[model samples]
Target: MTGDHAARPGMAAPRLALAGWVLFDWAAQPFFSLVQTFGYAPYFVRVMVGDPVAGQAYWGYGTAVAALLIAVLSPTLGAIVDQMGRRKLWIGATGAIYALCCVLLWFCRPGEPGAIVMALAAVCVAAVAIEIAVMVNNAMLPGLVDRSHVGRLSGLGAALGNVGGVVATLLVLTLFVANPGTGKTLLGIAPILGLDGAHQEGARAIGPFSALWFGCFILPLLLFTPDARPIRTGTPTIRAGLSALRASLRELPRHPALLRFLIANMIYTDGLVALFAMGGIFASSILGWTAIQVGLFGMLVTTAGIAGALAGGSLVDRIGARAVVLLTLGLLMAALAGTLSLGPDHVGPWAVAPPRPDRVLFDSAAERVYLAIGTLIGLCSGALLASTRIVLIGLAPPDRLTQFFGLFALSGRVTAFLGPLSVAVATQLMASQRAGIAVLMVFFAVGMALLATVKTR
Candidate 1:
């Protein structure tokens, strides 16, 4: 009836094991931070696709596909892994695929035949692999530390992930990803390694950079972290895994708090995912920011995320995960409203900052407002994500931890496509990126309402 690990309930894992486990987040984050959100995605939309509107739609569709795949497979894999045990092997297998896919992205050069298709395929596969790997990693959490320390560990991991993101973004901006107009990086120097800004080779290098970062950082976890023992010797059979999954599904309704929390997570995580997926593209298309500018903004957001996650983790034990979630959600809604209100010339129809031909980076009032709003969004989002994980740990049965973590991934990803797809559809219908992004507000509001009904102890 206990979580599947050698560590007894309430016993702390060894410090080495704990450090290794926490470092996995640092290892895994660059893929999301650089490739998915800040660096490669914006490049894909802006330069490779060459029309912001069409590119956003295309990117959305691709993200939807990845989310749908994650939704369908995560729970099933969780069940299978629960039967097979030893999460490290699964993590290694998926991490290899994820890393390889990222490296392959270097081939997706603009104007190359089939480059677009190749890029989309690589991204979609990598996304799915990483999400599955993350599910397995999350399953390891309940076993890592005592219940009392769960929130702190989870929050610390998220904070480290943001730190990784910030470092990775900075690296890309400094070493590669030059401003096309000036042929310079953020540091006023040409991109190192002869990376041509005109050919966008610098931007394309984000893929390989992320891959290298992941490969290097993941080794600590594999080398030092202890994995759960196998439930039984040898490979687990598909039939047995299916039976276990069915049993878990049938038993779900008995835990009303867990179910409600999952549902709420399902709704809100979609909004969060969509927001992350679109944020860079929105900046490029709506704000007319260049890749370097977007990367800088990403650094700002990620720096804020680190602070928020650390604070949230600290508050979880004191205020409770539920309170942290609620507070962060409220903050997220307000920040999102502020985000949707701003444009190049105006903030919520005031027309305050007109276009200045002589303007430098982030000089206008509108841009400044956006930077402030984005900081808040970053803070609230990091807290929201970490708190939600703690909420799941609080609500799930100790015995069924891995199976439920799978369900947790399912809940987070099941309707994930709807978030991106709705944004794509709304953007197409309204021909306005702002209108499309505004759709996420509804997801946040509905999730808050649903979360309120769950009675967390």
Candidate 2:
């Protein structure tokens, strides 16, 4: 893989490899979307674990474990990849770990003894492996095409992933989650393909479904993507790689811009991830959203995300990554304000007259306004994060792409525990979901201030 390939017109194999790489996201997002975001997390805390507050604590801790593990290993792996030049191998192995673990999610069930612990381990391990895979895959960016094309490819990949999420969410909503009160699926018929409603299998089945989706779609890049040329003399190669990794770690403080960008990203990205990871659970617990409602909301946000990613990617080239990111953060502040301001009835900051409590699903005008603000926030978040990838690619020194990207992933994931932990702590302290969400604004504001000084060019 080399940036030189961008000069050549119409390379079918590389295109296929790119598609295969993007498909990895398509394969992977279902776990994050359906299981973590929409269905399983809430199901785990509410039904499986039989407690919402304890569930939030457990969920936050599980994510913290993964983040800490990834933070420890990702940078070293990145440095080793740059030294050994075996990015593809690392990607393949880690991706396999992620896929298989996702499939194992099927075993988690309500009332199963030790199921929560086992599933949390699986989830954490899978999360760590997925981050490692991303570290390698993203390192491939500078080698895939010219600087001009990186944003577009990244955006396209994100858009495709969102599409995948939308499709998967819709399928699960239509097939698996039955409305307990109405006794009807989202599609207004019995769940398709004769899903057994007797055991509440719809929610459990997402694990295997995600596994299958990931496994089937991830093959092309393994076959078609070019692997880095191997270095000779195995023992010497390993020794040298270790030395190089050590050097990269030792050298980190010297690179101020890159270092600052990473630190800022670490803070903001953690908050972003925490918000999404816990959003559905909060809604289900507080707003009384069902699985069907969760699925529908996931689809809506995902659609907005895709649109934002495309727009952000293009805008990054014109307005610069710094501007795009700061703007996004500002929007996030407003969105959080709107979301938190809404009481049991009204929406958007404050209201002299709150709506009747009986109205639901953005039924009140204020609730509708809050949802609109939230949708905008989601859109900007998707775009800003996607653009951040391009910025990282541009800022990383040419020869150490993998090592730098590893640090990038590490920084993003390492502090991820803090946001959720804070949320968990705040939720417990206040006994309100809104208060927990309000805590995230501090992270966003501080990160934005730190990022404002970064030199994008």
Candidate 3:
């Protein structure tokens, strides 16, 4: 469990350990892709709140609260990791928080007093816990691979995560969430678990299902991945953790490149967060897509994401992390603008002269165009996140990798609430979801400008 053991490049065990580490990404994504982004989240907006526009605004407001808390705590915990010389223990602790919150999502009900508030609370807790777990997991990266290969491994993790998302979303769409009209799954079969469509169990099951999936998949990492040896600091672990964090904060001014990268990450990562958090709601409200159609959309997006992560990783090894990030951000900006332009029957001034209101599920030309635009978002999002981590790793001092990675979360969270909160405010002000979503463009544009100034290795 020492640093040397963590760095050792053994033949058989390292491969297995890497696989186990990657499996973590796989196990963790369903909370996001299925439960958070594409599945249960939409249910909250449509069924729980009962008004798409207001639901979206409130959802964003709740997410902002969670993001603010996570932003404040992630770096503190990371600083502790550097002192403790351990990652897995913190990961387990946070993983428990995440999985429990997810399982508790089952308690969400329709029309009860404070039902919406309780659901938002579960979402807030789950979001915070998952984010903490992710940062802790990233801190473990240096233990898994050499510096030269970090980009590829990061890319592989992103790709595998998307693969897991695709599978999880598909399973829920086909097995658990029955079609709203027909009360049958995508397979045209009766809902499994005798899912009470009356009480919306079919959709609600996504919570416990995601919890089970995460617990099962994280085992590979817990069982096989290497951990740093226990260090014997003279002070308590909490005291040492605080001192380490304080010292890192004081020394940050000496690192201009790292400083710039964090600023850029804070802006753009917020934009990315807003995109995923609200994408499903956008589709459900504007496109009128049910869980089945939404699941299909998730599959397509995740599949594209897998390709984007791999391609971005290859480019990171050749061109540079900075270049990859800039490219991805540009694509994301364009994709989002296109998405914002389209509504049910209109596309930013180009109206479908003959609007097909009679048709079901993405029947309009604008809807089809929106679907096409989502593919671009899917492709760029995976690459944007994968390469951003590589950029931070390159800029950070090797001795302080975990501490710096924690700052990465801090960077993302610092303004994380701002993006969604602004969207919430905008949606409320304009009374239009499209205009509210358009606010993300400001984050991306500012982020790209800051990213351009960083010097690459």
Candidate 4:
């Protein structure tokens, strides 16, 4: 399709319709924001499993499983969706599965005999479904309009998603999650629906809330975004897609720079994922933070992340994605160091006599230190993600950009399990969540070193 197709007056998709397309991100981020990062994830560690270290390991395993499925299936699914030409069908179907899995999370009560295992399975399935749906949603991008508005549209979409995360964090904090000691929200009231905060029902409620949030916000995309009419349709589409995917894999080795960058990204992005995945549990376990504190902290981090993404977008065009990736990775390394230095008994690696919670928000030296360092992690996470795609695009030949982008996604997925599994194994072996989290630094450092030598042009 010509770039001008979406920009011309007659051909352009309606503005409100386009806005709805961007709303996809706004609709989807609460899963990561509340369920995965801040709310229910911690509840798993603190309550469900009743052991922080074991809970971290179990959580990592779930993520690892999901990443494995995504890596194995995403490329083939993308190819099939392209052949089918009806992205909405896949998006709707996949989305329903994700929502159902999330709603089922309400069953993850602390004392239920199989609740933790069941929750893990639901999470794995839901995460895989979300990734697949996102793949289908992205595949529909070109057909929805044209290239002229793509960058701006994408930026708006991402910003809205980050903002959604912030809002979700705030809502979950004020409405559902209660302080560990007081069993009250920041609003100083009982959880909505009288959820038993004493038994952590309030915390576990993120599952159902995430489901409702996803379902309500995604209506615009389903109603407004246009789907491509299938060229081949159904069974034949899958067969053709498998054949095309096989050929594409055979073609990848000729593009060495793209290959290297993908490998580097695979290593680093997995590490980044692992860190954020463990962030909530780590805070709860080591810092003695309540659900309310974690929620408040998440609100702050998502806000910082949005600022970083905006800043990084400007910088990537000016300084090249390679430089941006290097700079962001460096910031993360430093942040990781700062994060590692903090423990309940210490501030910046200096161990002290048992310091108890005191004063106001982040009153203790350890909490203060962690907050400062964690802000840097938040800043780098969003920025690096924004920059990496541009870097990949810059490395690919214009004629083969689509194939290269697919390979890029494949690279990210192929070893996505490594970081989480490593964390899981490390945590289990050493019985330390910190040790597991610290392993991510190795990946970031390695990726930076690999990225330094890749040719961008």
**Full-model lDDT for every candidate:** 0.85, 0.74, 0.82, 0.84
**Tell me, what's the RMSD of every candidate?**
3.5, 4.0, 3.1, 2.9
lDDT of 3 by residue, 1-457 (tens): 3223365653223787888888989989998888778888789988999898899999999889999998778777766666777678777888888888888778877888888998899889988888888877877776678766876787688778878988888888788988777788888887898897545677789988998999999987887888777675546876877887777678789999999989999899999889888998998898778777777887888888777777887888888899999999999889888897777667889878433544566667886787788788887887877788889878999898866876676777777888889889999999999888999999999999999999967
Once superposed on the true structure, which residue ranges of model 4 sit more than 4 Å away at CA?
A: 1-10, 351-359
Candidate 2 TM-score over all chains jointly: 0.85
Candidate 2 lDDT over 282-377, as tens digits, reads: 766655566777778778788888778778878988988788889999998888887776654545445534444343445555545645765786
Candidate closest to the true structure, highest TM-score: 4
Candidate No. with top lDDT: 1
Q: Per-residue CA lDDT of candidate 1, range 201-267, in tens?
A: 8889998888888888888777776678887644445667778778877888999889988999989
Better of 1 and 4 by TM-score: 4
Compared to the true structure, candidate 3 yields what TM-score? 0.90
Q: List, in order, the clash count of every candidate structure.
A: 0, 0, 1, 0
- Candidates by lDDT, descending order: 1, 4, 3, 2
TM-score of 1: 0.90
